[model samples]
Target: MKSPLAGLSKFDFFGVLLLRIGVGAVLAFHGYPILTGGGSVWTDVGKGAAIASLPPSFFEYAGLASGILQFIGGILLIIGMFTRGTALLLSIVVGFAIANLIAAGSFQLGFLAHLQMILALLGLVFIGPGRLSLDRKGI
Candidate 1:
């Protein structure tokens, strides 16, 4: 008796679903602190964008916005709602941050996570949400 899921060997959609769940959970966890961190946390997050040379207050607001995007976008990814659009926006944000880190000569071990995120986002953008997603069922 072969495995019950042996027939699913060719089922790539399950892979997409797993990817969405894994990445979505990570992003949601990542955003939770920043989202609830208030002014200080926002300030810290904004500092990453300081390369833009914007005003101090602008950094704080930008951080808050980043938190919201990650939190909300993560949820959308998990449920397969607005999957492509959400992943597209997240790709932009992740790409910018990764580029900045590389520019800053911070290519350390921690940088791998950002690299993985960008790749995953790109995959989602190109492959779509698949039939397991709400986007597919018109939900």
Candidate 2:
């Protein structure tokens, strides 16, 4: 027998909206500190995204770019504007974060957070913002 909520497919858009807002808010919250903290803070945070043998100087720029993208993309996703593109870029950012977390030898809440977020972001990339979004007419 089908569950009562089996009909909830009609609410798929709401699911997308929830995903966007939730992920966007998180990105914005985390990005804000990096942006406001300037180069010094960026250098510290960029270590997460660092590739092999890259210097601290590279991290400064990487962090700066990541911060900008996270804040802007987060805002865009919240409003359902440019949802797919934002999700794609944010996926890369999350990828780096996940890699860093793994390399650091930890299995904390952050691991779960990034894991779920990446999955959602990738799904959003394919599923889009849906009918209730700015990309569609019902905004």
Candidate 3:
């Protein structure tokens, strides 16, 4: 006999899709002001200064790349195109940010934001794009 879970419908896919898009949208929205408006002063001037002081270029590149990657990944994720790949990429970016933040001895609010992104990434990885997603055609 089939497992009881076999009765699940494709409607569950929409749940996943909504989660991915909604979370991605929130993340993107949060970043938008920081990137385009005066908010960057707080983020860039405050954080960027210390980040720029890192020894190697990799750390600096990684720091700069995180915002760019996050913007791109958040857009892709919201659109549901290459959802898994984008989520995975976001996870990597957030993971690196978390590591750097910890290493820098600042674990208060930064850690919480990183953790939120990680949870969202994990949700996308497990639930996938769902039925409302671009990837649904393949399923």
Candidate 4:
């Protein structure tokens, strides 16, 4: 069968490039600080996880894992290397973040940012890296 996205054109590819870069930058911005911020950041993250009813160990390990995933995934996404895999992983992370925030009664405007990021990442997952990316051997 033909691919559903076979109709996507060069313009769509450009749009995908913009989306990938924007989402990648945002992920890096949020992740880099946590990764480099030392123990206190992990403590805070663990506390947030605790508030969301996760296990106590989640903060120490999962927090670090999350940061690493976001940091590395963001870089890969921006470079268009393994774009689908990166977007998919980041989408899962963002989805979990949204779920945790909502579960913790944080239904405020800030959570909207996570929701938007999830949507954008999901879009990238479906659209692929586009022609401007390294995935396509572009510059």
Candidate 5:
């Protein structure tokens, strides 16, 4: 069967671009403090993991890994380079953030924000970066 997206138009491209930039900006902002702040962020992550009864090593590695992924993935998303892969990775990070929030009993705006980020990233993964992206050899 033919792909449903075969008829994608310029408007679809613009929409995807908007979503990509918005999601990327949010991820980058969140990741920035963690990247520059040092191990304190990981310590908090470890504390949360401990409270959640997760393995200690998870905080050690996953914390660092998530930070790097978010920062780099956000940049890639903004540039529209490797858009699908970047969105997929960032979606995973957002999923983890939601899980962490739930485990910490943080049923607040932060959780909602991460949930939205996850949805947006997943949308990008499915819809692609659009014709205006580097992925499409556009400026």
Candidate 6:
């Protein structure tokens, strides 16, 4: 005895699909430049905030990891495969970035971005990955 609204699974699938894709794509897009070493992406957060205390190696690895995760997570989110898991992981990474910024006394911009990321991650955690996801199909 499913409710009438329960039958509208397709809409739910695409809705969640778009959310995941959009978020992931943005993250990947933002991360790509820094990861490739074309230039520093953390000019505002890392350099502008705490260049004196931050090591070059730390910046290098952080850039690489952020780019890789966002790129991979974005693609997976678009395809609806491992949506929640990827979102969770990316969320954690975002958290780390925020933490870094805060530690560097760049709480102004970093705090805002961190809060936004937290919201996105929280949505994925509670939303169950939507109907269009691989997890859904497997179920």
Model 4 lDDT tens row, 69-126? 8898998988899998889988987877887798879988879998889989888888
Question: Model 3 Cα displacement at 35 (Å)?
Answer: 5.1
Error of 5 at 62 (Å): 2.1
Error of 4 at 1 (Å): 34
Q: Pick out the ten consecutive residues of candidate 3 with the lowest summed lDDT.
A: 40-49
On a 0 to 100 scale, what is the lDDT of residue 86 in model 2? Answer: 91
> What's each prediction's clash count?
0, 0, 0, 0, 0, 0
Please write out the lDDT profile of model 3 over residues 1-139, one tens digit for every residue: 8788766764676677678878788767765654454433335523533455565544444445556666667888887888888888878766766776777789798799778879889778777777776777755
Model 2, span 95-139: residue lDDT tens: 998999899987899999999989989999999987777887553
Provide the TM-score for each candidate, comma-separated: 0.88, 0.89, 0.67, 0.81, 0.79, 0.68
Which segments of model 6 are wrong by more than 4 Å? Answer: 1-10, 38-59
Each model's lDDT comes to 0.87, 0.88, 0.69, 0.82, 0.79, 0.70
| C-alpha RMSD values across all candidates | 2.9, 2.0, 4.8, 5.5, 5.4, 4.7
Clashing pairs in 2: none
Question: For candidate 5, what is the TM-score?
Answer: 0.79
After superposing candidate 2 on the true structure, give the runs of residues whose Cα lies further than 4 Å from its correct spot.
Answer: 137-139
Winner of 4 and 6 under lDDT: 4
lDDT by residue (1-139, candidate 1, tens digit) is 8999888878878899999988888888888898999999998887786666678898899788888888989999999989999999888878767877887899887678899998999999999998799999664
Off by over 4 Å in 4: 1-10, 47-55, 137-139
TM-score of 1: 0.88
Considering lDDT, which of the candidate structures 3 and 4 is the better prediction for this target?
A: 4
Q: What tens-digit string does per-residue lDDT give for candidate 5 at 3-122? A: 888776637778778888888888888878777656768666545534447766666666677778888888888888999999998887778778879977998999988888888888
